[model samples]
Target: MPVKTENAEQLSRADREARGKDAQAVAPLESNAEFTPGPSRDPVGLLLEQEKTRVPELLPVRHGRMLVSPFTFYRGAALPMAADLATTPTSGLRVQLCGDAHLSNFGAFASPARRLVFDVNDFDETLPGPFEWDVKRLAASLAVAGRENGFTAKARRKIILAGAESYRTAMRAFAEQPFLAVWYAHLDVEDAIAQFRSQMKKKRVKATEKMVAKAHTEDSTKALRKLTTQANGQRRIISDPPLIEPVEQLFPDVRVDAIYKLLREVLGKYQRTLQSDRKHLLEQFTLVQVARKVVGVGSVGTRCWIALMDAGDGTEPLFLQPKEAQASALAAYCGRSPYASHGERVVAGQLLMQAESDIFLGWTHVTGPDGVDRDYYVRQLKDWKFSFPIEQMIPSGMAAYAQMCGWSLARAHARSGDRITLASYLGGSDQFAQAIADFAETYADQNDRDYAAFQAAAKDGRVQTTTDI
Candidate 1:
């Protein structure tokens, strides 16, 4: 389907009035509700189960040095927390939320028009859930990441508050804008840089420029060079044991071959999922190489395969990521999704949330050797995708960055949700902001304790981890 585009002027006066009224109504609910806690389960056991099922390789050891860090452990434990969070009370406001809205998840990528743009890139944990879940997760992640970056506690708190305030402020602004104006909103790099230029000091602008330049360094060729290495003159994914596991690991039971074959079959299915025009465009491409590439802290062990396909020329290639689709954590609380296939759910959600998406977005089911069907969602692995290094940002820069994330996230939610109801719930006041800020501080504390507990567990031989990547 062609991307939906709305001009600023398309937003009618009546639409603006409706949004303002809606925001006025929903503001009261923010103070009325309390955060419901997740189930009182053994967090360690839950982490282990998720690790075993999705990414067992991350559980191994290398060189007698286990790859178990508090951070890595926290990444693996989202499933249990998701389950627990589901049972809690919510504002009854739902959106197509990023199931895992960590700070690291926001990034930059090239649009289909070849224009560089920034937005949320990771959607692995995506599902329909309470909007506040995403906001809290993002705010807490900002705190954790800021702490890791050597920022002062006050700086970290300020960053989190800035992020929350941005969301609240942006939502109110969006609530006041006409529907079409809200729909048309987006942040291009030039515009983003300009916004930063106005808000930040000269030194900070230089720093942000440097960061943007660094992100630009990792284009398609750079991605290919990093992902593929020379193996007898044939470019292939480097098979570094523990880190880059070859298909051989999943073989012997012939599961590796099965997965490869299934991938080809699924690619064909994915093609069918596209509109005919896109399928024709894709047909011009030829498959070159396929490899199992472990990626990210949370997705370290999930079945992630990358296919390098050549377009018109051998040098021009597109990378496709067919990631394993596990059941969504939001499913329990949000109730059953109407989507019969998990892949469909992901594809549909992506289409709804993203302003523009890869032409290859689709899904398929692959039956494993155990006769169990695993759902898979396919998309461009990295088509000019980029993210700022959280560790590199200064306190003020981080705060500014958090605000951008909040604004982008609110826009995304507005696109896929009932704006009137959400605006009504959020209201014009900062009560929701204050509430989220309070929740974020508490959750950050909880996250630190959980992170510490995970480290203790690792040290005590209660859980296993592999750190080499």
Candidate 2:
């Protein structure tokens, strides 16, 4: 997958810096502060349009989750913001975007090397677009979350600025590094804790340590103990309705054996996409059973499944998640993805943006019984996964998290975009960061307005919430 500004790599360092300066000259840093939505914009209607692409029966669940709060609504409203971002000025610098770079999207997971690392963990709406778009998405998420947490206006501004400033400074630092150095760069969670350990109180450090310990306990073996039960002397996924429905329950008309056979075939196709080493590793296990699972506030309506596999010796259990990948929300404003399938688009974007990727990461195109084809990407489930407790964060804790997210985002963008040019456009001052902070506050206001309109629609029966399977 080629980036929009790949040609910049051929230019000399001086020339690349000049290109950034030229972009800054045309779109000044202060110009990014403006946020004027067109009069005809209909946020609720935009969401209604996206609803058409999701699983019809699960629509209410998505709506119910989004209606939980304004921040929740913002999570599912990525398309509307993509449209809003189209109206903002760009620096003309493009990168493989996370497209939905909210704070919750950044989390800790085990890298292929078995090291705990923090990076952007979601790429469902990834595509190539203006570098500012991703940064703004991240900054705005902070503002919205801060409001939900009851932070004061001044405190929220400080948190947002911390993220934006960290991004600018980090990009400048990366601009001075060699290509290989930048590509190999990563943020180890342990190292992060050590760096902050000195600055934090004893109780805070202990809490952080406890989180890391908990992550180590999350793996295939633990998942087997929690999500499966002995039935007919064979392991099977437990039925939990709406949230986690077993194959037998989801498709009563289809034979269980045939469903397992199809799952075997899907995994076979998916394995071909992995490297030779990983393909061989996957061959050691046999598929046990699968379950349909609803995950995340924004992804509730997607087709997601968890596959359980057992080693012949019956000791190691492996869990793999195959999730549907639709066309990116950013595709409408930025050009269509260069990849032939949305699955490949997600896998390619994840590989480009993350310092390290899961060994089993792969994509496949499957034809369902309804004669419709869909794209999906596969990865291990609950493998040392952990999310920051954003709702419980104090202002100082959030400020620290803001720095890590910002630094991580800059590193990701630097790998795909021209770092020298972006650094030049940002300059040495805090002007661009200040402008983004302003945009974040304004965008949070827009999110509230959209939430209010959505609530009204719910009253008129345009949307409803239910847990009935």
Candidate 3:
């Protein structure tokens, strides 16, 4: 389970270059190849299998969300993509991957340093894999999303190619920097704005700024107002069945005192995983309420809970989300995680790839009344976070967004992989970019076919959906 690196430090730049060139023998460049569906491959069956581990009641909600469009379907279909990617060509260079590196997964969030930074925020499927796997997934997503945004097929190809080029150039830059400098590299909000301003229209710049302003308003205190209300002069989470409900309401059979006691024990264990200062800081808050909350399309069926805490002062609040962490979709294809719990696996991967992370980030195991053990990673909820709105995307806007994703992803890989080798393999040519563009186009077509199949399944009653909100 040791992380893969080529002992690349021993090689001179030229040697690394040669090694990169040698990779072409194993996997040729410029061949983005087609996907011929495997005779036994049933995408719907695969999705059904994934649902087995999810909360049974939420399965319909998950399916309903993914039914929105091909883009959303692509978002939730990471498992199938992982399977397909395993059959694709590789240069045999491995890195810690953001296994579901679709465009939507890149977003802006406040770092622990209190600076707004853009990075890959989702790590549910992260694992060690061929570096190209991430790039291909990203490229394909751009194509799918761009089509959804009404971009021409030709225009979408350009966006994918442009993103691949950005990744190649950014990786090369990181390869030349001092190791410590590369480790410290991060794209703060100002850096992000400046880059976008240089490459985008004024209108888009203003729009991005507006989005950033909106993100600043999302935090625990704000969440308290929206999701909680005073009960007997104390704050309690509001109950809205299906979407948000008290744990007691969801599990009516369980004693409320027992639920609180179990959570207190879990929180105590979670605190031990934090640094001393963070642990001390957490001691200031008192947990008051807990509720089950549904999250994103892909994450819908997972057991996610939000805790409301009083920050000692009556008016202030702290909210923490303990999201269930299952074994990564990439785990089976790559290898099992070395960490004892999937929660720990997620925490380790996030800390390694992000330049800055949640100060409260930690992991613990929780056993339900059924004697089932579930791993969860805890972090502050909605502490300044927002995603780019795909509805507003235009070809030019998409190109800029793609570049940002490419740059952010490269920085993540640089932190965990052999940078020099990766950059060298990318080379000083457009061959890689063109190849990825071709791959993106072909894979996007495959995604549409899968999405159609999904739609048909739902229509045929093979897939259930929940539309009631």
Q: Any residue pairs clashing in model 3, and if so which?
A: none
lDDT of each: 0.69, 0.91, 0.88
* Model 1 per-residue lDDT tens digits across residues 66-159: 2343334445556655765565446656678877777778888777787667777767667777777788778767766776678887787788
Q: What tens-digit string does per-residue lDDT give for candidate 2 at 331-445? A: 8899988899899999999999999998889999888766699999999998899999999887877888998999999999999999999999999999998999999999999
Q: Count the backbone clashes (under 3 Å) in each candidate.
A: 7, 0, 0
In model 3, how large is the Cα lDDT of residue 172?
95
Q: Which stretches of candidate 2 lie over 4 Å from their true place?
A: 467-469
The pairs that clash in candidate 2 are none
Q: What is the total number of backbone clashes in candidate 3? A: 0
Give the TM-scores of the predictions, in the order they appear.
Answer: 0.85, 0.98, 0.97
Give the candidate number with the greatest lDDT. 2
lDDT of 3 by residue, 1-469 (tens): 3365756777788887777778777777764444556777788888899888899999999999999999999999999998888778788888888889999998888987788998899988888888899999999999999888889888998899889999999999999998899889888876778867877888888888888898999998899999988888888899987899898898789899998999999999999999999999999999898999999889999999999887775577889999999988887788898888899888888888888888999999999877899999999888898898976888988898899899989989988888887887888898989989988888998999999999999999999997665
**TM-score head-to-head 1 vs 3, winner:** 3
- How many residue-pair clashes does candidate 2 contain? 0
lDDT of 1: 0.69
